[model samples]
Target chain A: MYMSVAELVDAAKKTKKPIYELVIEQEMDTSHNTREEIWDAMGRNLDIMAAAVKKGAEGEGVFSKTGLTGGEAVKIKNYRSAKKTLSGDLMMQAVQNAVSTNEVNSSMGVICATPTAGSSGTLPGVIFTLKDRLDLTRDQMIQFLFTAGGFGMVLANNAGIAGATGGCQAEVGSASAMGAAAAVELAGGTPEQSAEALAMAISNLLGLVCDPVAGLVELPCVKRNAIGVGNALISADMALAGCTNKIPADEVVAAMDKVGKGLPSTLRETGLGGLAATPTGVRMKEKIFGKAVDAKA
Target chain B: MTVNYKSVFDIIGPIMIGPSSSHTAGACAIGRAANSIFQETPTDIVVHYYESFAQTHKGHGTDYAIISGILGFEPDDSRVPYAIGLARDQGINITFIEEPEDSPINHPNTAIIELTNSKDGKKVTVAGCSIGGGTIEIRGIKMNGFDIKPKGPLPILLVPGSEVDQQNVTDQLTALTKVNEKKQYQSAKGDLFEYDLDRRLKPEEVKELAKNNTNLVYL
Candidate 1:
């Protein structure tokens, strides 16, 4: 019944419990599942996420039939190792992890959707990066997922989560928000602060469209996940530094829903507008699919 | 309206092989749903892709995913990549149609599957959509105009056609196990009896039910 972000935070605060713990309690009460069972399931998800990250980072990424994505993650990793990037070590690492996961996704590798498969990279990217920086235990990492899940459920229930329904703002935007909130909670910020982080993260990506080149998630989708990682980290840091969102988390989600609805169908994963319709995108499609649409180009 | 998400798994995971959840995993589930609608294994299938699905199915591997599903493969099965070749080897005739832009269906990730049972020459058309995150909704079934959305873990069966005794079938299944929910649709062709059981019925039991009722469809 308590489905709003504010309500979830309030419940957690009232119980003097972490948001993740409250979510655990709620899951137990509703599903009649044992804590061990829930933890085991989450543990499996983490294992898969970890394995995909490792495989992608190691340059063993499988190729999409379109051949648009495969080894970019390894390229990023190689770049990070050779140079000192402007984003610092942790951010660069996060970017590498994010790209790796999304590349794995593009290659048809098994991945856990951190909301949806299109947005899977953001949470794992930020989490793995913070795992080393924060010295988080495996159990704590799982709890971070729960924390993210808690807010994700709220956003999904309130606004939406699918790209086709709400544009990339729904997929990447919601994932980034969920990742930011979990990052805040992991950093020992208050539940309210976590909500602020979520708001900031989502607000930053408002009006973003789901315009993949050639209508494949490989092109801008994989790279956008890399950006989402940095977006989450920055939002988390801002929230930790006492930055506040003027519009609350729930309202921001509602606004995002409205904006997504207002987007043209072409901008919402239809492949008819934005980057998908660009001349280069058309050229790439022609190169991959050939001039099949025309008798002869 | 709230999406019926059973668990956090609904949010974070389906553990699927994918480039796109809406196009791949969910499409596989829709294919599975289409498979379930058949009385026996379908030897022929004609799929009509709609909107975005028609535009980018190849890039997202929607066609492969659906073919794999028709072959009774899950979304994560490695065989999904080679589903077309496998189906060809199995002697299944496959065809595709790009639904016109003015089609009545509105969902971006939608497909209408026409399946033919080789043995009986029975046919069924399933209009389904991949609603993202490996979830699917069977928007309609062409036999008797059934509008069903399968949301449970159990395999749902749709006995379409008026000749079959709907009450008797429901009673038989309800006697064997609790029927979680039941829905019915009356169309010009027949009465569609849809039942959601608490668990999958035993194969032998399903055989008995099918053997007894000629008009029964299992979906």
Candidate 2:
């Protein structure tokens, strides 16, 4: 169930008519503040377990490592990866590299969202900013979280979040779609608008892949969240504004399935395709993982 | 009536954790967040399961997620259902309302999960949407009938700037009000509760904290 590019583009073009009583909002905290909030909190939360990580590494503790907690975790989440070193934190660093560098890979930025862990950061970066204006109580925020989670849940159940299996469209595409839907709801758009936002957002990033270099979550993944948030917001608003697309949301997901299946295993988070196949990728893996896995047989 | 058709996906098991992370794990996360949000933890719950979740909820472990979430269970908890039972033992009334099947469509994964401590005469209503893969978003909330989505546009940032004429205010709020009528605009040019967050939360300080793998669930 996936919408084609031409269908989405054509429908998106109609959004310019602006029937949604459209309103856009921005809040600043840090660069890509929404995703950063999670990352920063991840960073701060690390402090709680600094002694724990050390203790685990020291053998006093076996496999126990402490981590970020609450808002602090939300804050520095993206940057928690060891930036000073060449070998960045795996999941976060992969995301950062995708957003920061121009290595020219389709594996670049994606919108992370929902239970849609693959695109988790996609909506938070966008919605939290809108949240700043809503004066939402902790309870309200929880509701917003719940609302977003529901759509993500649907995506996960219907489509797969694993890029290796379902592909990038399942991961990032779903996230962006969920993000947009949530944004529309929080923005006071009708449920119809919310659905439209989600469908539009999903159709936009259908058929992306995971395939981070070194089989790590770093690379284009980090910044992808930021861009995804932006796209989610734009497309969501477009959806809410009575802009109808020819391709339905389910069609988009199906298209993603097709694309993901067609992708080479190397491109599906195997660390064999995309940037992971590059010479720098092999070097990085050797430096970090200390293993030489070939890009191909 | 001319019906604008919308595609639908049913019984989607979110891809995050299990059992069905969005239904279970992410529900737990939101449920837990709700527990901590209230001035006091809810001793009762009025739960509404929209669409498919209502039908297959018990099997999906959604009841456990809500109960355990109220008790603040992590997504990976083996004792989640136990926690829900605990809520029952503690006299926390759990009412699950299923939306009429074949209801008008919106976000397929949305639900209205409400919590209340009837004994205390307090209530919290949460409107949430769960995405695939155990992720969640809170769309709105009604606490004692207080609406929470900022009733206006342009999230006011405390970046500190000089006064600007209407032409210079090129913010989303401005653009929204000028064109998008449906947008609720909140004038936040001067609201700075966390002014000079250096005195409050600092970047370096935040960086110092990220070392741990603590999970931060958004409000």
Candidate 3:
């Protein structure tokens, strides 16, 4: 199996196939499943993602059980409609969708975990936004998932994807890198360009810790997904514009792994550091769960 | 250590109801794995949460997730949010205990569940950890004084009963698919034969094996 971005890009180039096609071929070989079965499974995931985006962006805002996160996505949508946004419609739409998906997740709604649930919003945000802007076909959108999953596999294997294991750098950071790489491919950029996008995205989010407020996937987690989409979009555009990273994608992934490991346990989803330890955060946790429970780092 | 991500889906999806994959989906998956070994709905359960799970389970809906999974609900099942009520309706009693954060545990997200079957008065203890990305590792199982620790991520089959013919079951499984690993443990209650297979056994295959081995109480 291809273990690194270099290997994946090399195989894609040699076979004269896009990264998504190579990913599909590898999945077929490893799973021993028919191509139709694999494609149909991903199609199901796409349906879930689309449904979540629609529910979050258009439906009445859903509140989390904790009452910590809700309505922000709708607020953004209304704001973008009423006022001119500084980031333009595309970026704001992605940001809206990203926050919306995370809100849905925080409310215990069904979502396809793009690498992981905490980081699920970024990919769907980028994908659905591209669909609206690029008028991408259903198959192309599924291809976007495959391309993203391809790069995600590399990061997951080489570095990590769990917030508890490697902080938010591994969760939302990896998701952003995957989204950026997939965006490059969806825009018809070369594998090398995809790698550059992936590298740039990871480098940008390096050392981003995982400190969810109130030990819930709310607060900064939802907003961070919005930021992740913005980062991915900018990185993809830069790669498409011929920008490259001094550090390779694989090395960046390795660097993220190192940085994540070096981070204190308090910063790695323990809810004991960062914003989670803020007085308001601690008070919120007490109000929701009672003060008797000591939230250990 | 590399995870050897086998499929694109492993990275892209595990369509689930979630606030957190590790806390909710992975916790549910661990419950499902334990339920599979239990072979039936448990009448009573006591779950011990450790470290991170102890700290954040309520916010993540991990209690509901695990209960729904033990009720045979998938991670994405809509019934998950109502699992507590459903469990109560089914006359299943559940108690949750939070272990101290300083408890000596290998993983931060860990749960040790003890399941009791009212009909047979059988008790099984399962210890599992959420390693992340909606994935779980069944670290150990304790049944009738025998402890079984599985080593890898491969699909596992357990055949537990009195005087189970290990060779016959192994032969049957070998005929159906490759067995990567096998262990046989003898306890006062029965002989527990476990096999780690190359892939998950199909329902028909499981049925065929059980039909052939009368002593195979769990598969």
Top lDDT: which candidate number?
3
**What is the C-alpha lDDT profile of model 1 across A133-213, one tens digit per residue?**
999999999999988887887887677777777888888888899999999998999989999999999999999999888
- Output the worst ten-in-a-row residue range by lDDT, candidate 1 chain B: B146-155
Give one digit per residue, the lDDT tens place, for model 2 in A87-127.
33332332322222111111111222243333554544454
* TM values, all candidates: 0.87, 0.40, 0.92
TM-score of 2: 0.40
Better of 2 and 3 by TM-score: 3
Give the TM-score (0 to 1) of chain B in model 2: 0.59
lDDT of 3 by residue, A179-215 (tens): 9999999999999999999999999999999888878
lDDT value for model 2: 0.46
Model 1, C-alpha of B147: deviation from truth (Å): 6.6
Q: What is the C-alpha RMSD of each candidate to the true structure, in Å?
A: 4.3, 19.6, 2.8
Name the top TM-score candidate. Answer: 3
Instruction: Note the DockQ of each predicted structure.
Output: 0.43, 0.04, 0.59
lDDT of 3 at B55: 73
Candidate 2: where are CA atoms >4 Å away? A1-113, A291-297, B1-219
Which of candidates 2 and 3 reaches a greater DockQ? Answer: 3
